[model samples]
Target: MIKEIAILVYPGCMGMEVFALTDLVLMANHLAKNMHPGKFSALRVKLVTLRPNPVAIAGGFKVAAQRLRGKPDLIVVPGLEVSRFGEWDERFARLGQELKAIRRFHGQGTELASVCIGSFVLAEAGVLQGRRAATAWPFVSEFQDRYPDVQIEKDAVILSDGGVTTTGAVSSVMDLGLHLIRESMGSAVARAVSKLALIDGGRVSQRAYVDTALIPQNRAPFSTQVNRWLAQRLSETYNLCALADAFNVTSRTVLRRYRQETCMTPLQWLQKARIEKAKHLLELSSMSVAEVVVAVGYHDLATFSRLFARETGQTPGHYKRLFQGKRVATFPRG
Candidate 1:
């Protein structure tokens, strides 16, 4: 059974990604303690870092490391924002040494995991070769370009290729940890941990946003045209073929271009745009559902309702009620 774990921290790391892993692990530990006292002890966790001080992240957040005496059973490396202006910062060189040392510990049979962009660190170490991995969708192309040997699956939430696990994004780290708990202990334990953490395992897959296929390289022209067209004809009925014809392209080409640029097909994009318009009308205006549907270019109320529910995970009526409730809560009666 895996007991000890460590989470690597460094400057430029995403605060939320690190917390997702630690939160899930801590929840699993808590559930273990509640289920059987003294039977299965909580996993040991250490925040490992290069320096003996706290490191600053992108959004002005800093995290301190907890010193470790020995190698842990698992080590989690959270993602960091890459600087596009040039090569990785010099601070990453020191982090590289820390990663190498952690790998040496992993070579002794300790399992390794990474969250979102943290896969880059693992790729630099040359450990992910021939391994299937996943990272944030936006970085998928860059990651593949940098590490061609690694089989990076774009659709996976949490990929485990021979004990080197990687999650797609920050939120997916929570899913990854729950998966680890299930593997180490049992499904029962994982379910209990999910309950305590208030996470739905089923929703984990739906939240993933990466796509690995070769997408269109340029999107400015397409996005601009689409936005203008969408804005002017909010009440007009639109179709994929019509939009494609307007752009003088085939439907398939339009679909591919849209997917590459926005991570959504034309239809999905239309629905999202419609939903946003509907939300504004519901919140800022006194438009009813029927009027909102017409305003947002939808003729069928049923279709609009279904699409809205799928997009937001709540019925339009329920969303309206919740939004209204929040507004009312903010402005109480005198």
Candidate 2:
């Protein structure tokens, strides 16, 4: 069985994702023929462009593509290179045709999938509304803020719901490609392709890869002021009375106002801030876990360790191990 796929291209799309996805699909076909010839299945692919002319992708690269050549079995939306917040709207405004194409294909019963911030397009097209989806980690808050009706699977590397699939970050294209092959050709062929390509198919969660410093801050004025207070005194002992006093409010009023603005109590917000700080020190500084605990204003090492593990889905030592010896590693100069 050969499945038809229309890989959508738009301006500012990540070139690596476009090539990597096609490369993975080609490898899957090669592996399927060798490993599962009897039940062989493959994807017949085509590149579709939103613009009539050549698509200008990221890093000053241009890709030539044709318009959609009718409905396909699946439509793949690769990630885009998003430099900052608020730029998403500007970018999406130019993707009117591409967004329409996505909506049209979905209405024609075609399965849809997006990678990284490409989920933004699907959400903009309204197909991801009322469905559980996953987007790039740093953009989750932004995504949530923009599309309040969509359910974001915060940690999953890939999520599928309502005939739509979404994957985290650009690198997740490998995982998404393997998943497509596995759905049609079976896991044996996918496993063989993964082994040949050195792509790990067992990736399940993006939890450990999260960097809280990249998470957007809550914009509410009260939440803003509260966060400012926490940042200035991250090493100070917590005292609700003092915090309330700092804001010139009663403790009960502080709690009520904080919950109203941030949906979390004052203590919870402070703990989150502390954990983010601890993660940074653990990665960049040579601080011991005990020292990190004290640096985050927690005297009890065990409690801080547990909180770190809970927030990051890995122990402080384990998280540090993942980044060991990389601090001084330099990249080749361009």
Give the top-scoring candidate (lDDT): 2
lDDT (Cα) of model 2: 0.85
lDDT of 2 by residue, 1-334 (tens): 3398788888888987788888888988887777667666567778888686788899878799878777778888988777777788788888888888888889988999998888998999999989999998888888898999999988889999978999998899888988988887888888888898888899888877887767667789987898899889999998899999999999999999899998899789889889888888888898888888899999987888888888888898988888655756678998
How far in Å is the alpha carbon of 250 misplaced in model 1? 12
Superposed Cα deviation of residue 214, candidate 2 (Å): 2.0
**Poorly placed runs, candidate 1 (over 4 Å):** 19-27, 52-70, 81-94, 102-109, 137-155, 206-223, 238-334
Whole-model lDDT values for every prediction? 0.73, 0.85
Per-residue lDDT of candidate 1, residues 14-50 (tens digit): 8887777777777777777788677666766678776
Error of 1 at 146 (Å): 4.8
